[model samples]
Target: MAETRTFDVVVLGGGSGGYATALRAAQLGLTVALVEEGKLGGTCLHRGCIPTKALLHAAEVADAARESETFGVRATFDGIDMAALAAYKDGVVAGLYKGLQGLVSARGITLVEGHGKLVSPDTVEVGGERYTGRNVVLATGSYSRTLPGIEIGGRVITSEQALELDYVPRSALVLGGGVIGVEFASVWRSFGADVQVVEALDHLVPAEDLAVSKALERAFRKRGIGFTLGDRFASVAETDSGVRMTLESGKTLDAEVLLVAVGRGPRTAGLGFEEQGVRLDRGFVVVDERLHTGVGNVYATGDIVPGLQLAHRGFAQGIYVAEQIAGLEPAPIDESGIPRVTYSDPEVASVGLTEQAARERFGDDAVETLDYNLAGNGRSKILATQGFVKLVRRKDGPVVGVHLVGARVGELVGEAQLIVNWEAHPEDVAALVHAHPTQNEALGEAHLALAGKPLHAHN
Candidate 1:
């Protein structure tokens, strides 16, 4: 016996993208059903973003306490208490999960709990029951990806396992130098682990602008975090104590654990997506700029949509899809308008085009860039951190990109994104006074130089 239900909207895989779409659709007065095989809030809230960030904060606290002597504060740099730290991380996740659960309940959106498979364009099957809707949203998120012949077990683990470890190892070898890799490397190094990062790319966070990559590498080196760039993995052999890894560069390293911080792959298998006529490219649901799928009355959003695979990007895409389905005629999302951040030590944040990207698109002579050192920033100087803000603008037009690196610079990307998205000229931003003695003033200083009025910076 199977149950049958109908709704104005149905969202599959209640992750960041799916839940957001369902919530927005319900707010638009559409009856919505949100299906989930696991708990709500998805990876970002549950495992990926929230938990990892908690670890980073704990690491930062440890670093701050260790360096308190420099600040004239009398404090001892005690070692980490793994149990208490884990509990704190879990507490943060639990609190956010509770809030999200309450929000879903309050919205009156039907929360169906089970694995859902798209049986048709507008219908999903879960637990032998059929759920039909006028429109369907596919938001199945992503999973931790590993390379060929790389077995993840025992001492070899992914970020998921790394988060749950009750004890920190004496040494750790992190693979991949992207967001997840560098972040975990930073955390373990702070926790007193002998950390070594193996990145196949030429630099850590290779996707970021070259200058940002160089700065992060320098900071990581100063922290004594060793890394081998432009090298590929050859093999891994497990021993009683730990694992032995050999690189293609003839280098061998051993560690108590190998944290595979490689990227994530979309979780779009066995859900009957393509069988239902939904277009898919290499496991990602194919959708147009407006998020409409090839299948009639069906849409896809989030990590399943072959873009940034970021939670906030999922949030924006989910909202856009919901409004589009409601016939609201919302603007199509510009993927470039989305912001990115790497929450490692000396964080990296950016929005809009890179200087190289701008030069390619707008020509080298037509693009101007300014790099404002954090040494001139009172807040950064007080924090005893080093980095810079790099801004890219059209020769005689608007600001097109903003890149920042240093402590707490991730918080400033909000204003950076606004400048890029709003197409404001350098003078437009320079005219607005940022409060003095703040790291945000570093951004203002970059714009001032770009606007021909160098302030607190060498012209």
Candidate 2:
């Protein structure tokens, strides 16, 4: 005889999406049980987003100290204590994890710590305990993917190890110049590392607009960071002093460390989706418009599902699924409404379509763009930032996109997302008064220019 724990909802993985689902479901008066093999808050809170951002902030502070002379202050610093920095980062992540645990507990969600796999359509096995649920949600999250023969080790590292390193290396090579790669490269470059970015693509951040990619290339070049765009890494060999990576371009880059920032993949293996008849698509758990799989009463969300792999996006999806289960007609999630932000020195953010994509879909004449340089803005001038705000609109339709590249531009993503999701027109925003000399004013001015009413900007 075995003990059977039953619930209205059983969320597997307990990561951002799972925990959020459990909490929201519990709040909706449904009994929820969350099963997790690792820590409660998942990668974003423990290892991925939270810790990496904190370490990057520390690197940014060190860089700021070096530039203090420009502000008429002589700010000197000793070398960065990597161990102490790791401890501080750990404390920050731990505190957030505690807070998440408190929330889950307060919501009356049962926390089950163990590895879980689907036993049946509405049943999961955790630590040899079979639990049945009225509904099941999968939120296993993802892991760092590496290239073949590129094993992660002491010198050959991934972003995971890069975050826990004892000290910043003097020289390093970052493989993959995507969001994560550029972010770490920016951090190391600011910390005085001779950082080189090896991107197989022809440009950095290949997903962004060509103009934005060129802007970052120019910005990195001005800052002395090296780039080997359109080059691929053949292999990594460790030497007595450091590690060396042979590039497909017949060149070898030697550095104290090599950080692999290729990308992440869903944690779908060994979870028994195949055995349970839960459909999968290209290694990710497949879900329909309702986020339900073939398995009756079973659902999935977050990185495991086939969509954008953002923590906030995962949060929204989880809450929506819970509300839907509670018989609430929560509006379907629009993936385009999710904003993407790269926290490099000059952050890049985009919501909705790109200029090229918009033109292709709506024809050349139907698409309009307003590129407003940051130098003309009072807020950017105060920070000495170089970049612009780009507004993309259909000639006769609503505004469709907002792309940005500049200092602190990531903060503008909230408004950009709202405009894109709400289908707000340029005139709609331009008509509204924006506070003067603020970063948001730059957006408003760009919108005004797009609406054919140029104000405080060159036409």
At residue 129, what lDDT does model 2 achieve?
92
Q: Score residue 68 of candidate 2 by CA lDDT.
A: 77
lDDT tens readout by residue for model 2, 23-122: 8899899999999999998988987888878877887778678777876889986668778888889999989999998998888888889899988888
**Model 2 Cα shift for residue 328 (angstroms):** 0.7
Regions of candidate 2 where Cα sits further than 4 Å from its true position: none
Query: Residue 222 lDDT in model 2?
Result: 90
RMSD of each candidate relative to the true structure: 1.0, 1.4
Model 1 CA deviation exceeding 4 Å by range:
none
* RMSD versus native structure for model 2: 1.4
* Model 2 clashing residue pairs (backbone): 82-166
- lDDT on C-alpha atoms for all candidate structures: 0.92, 0.88
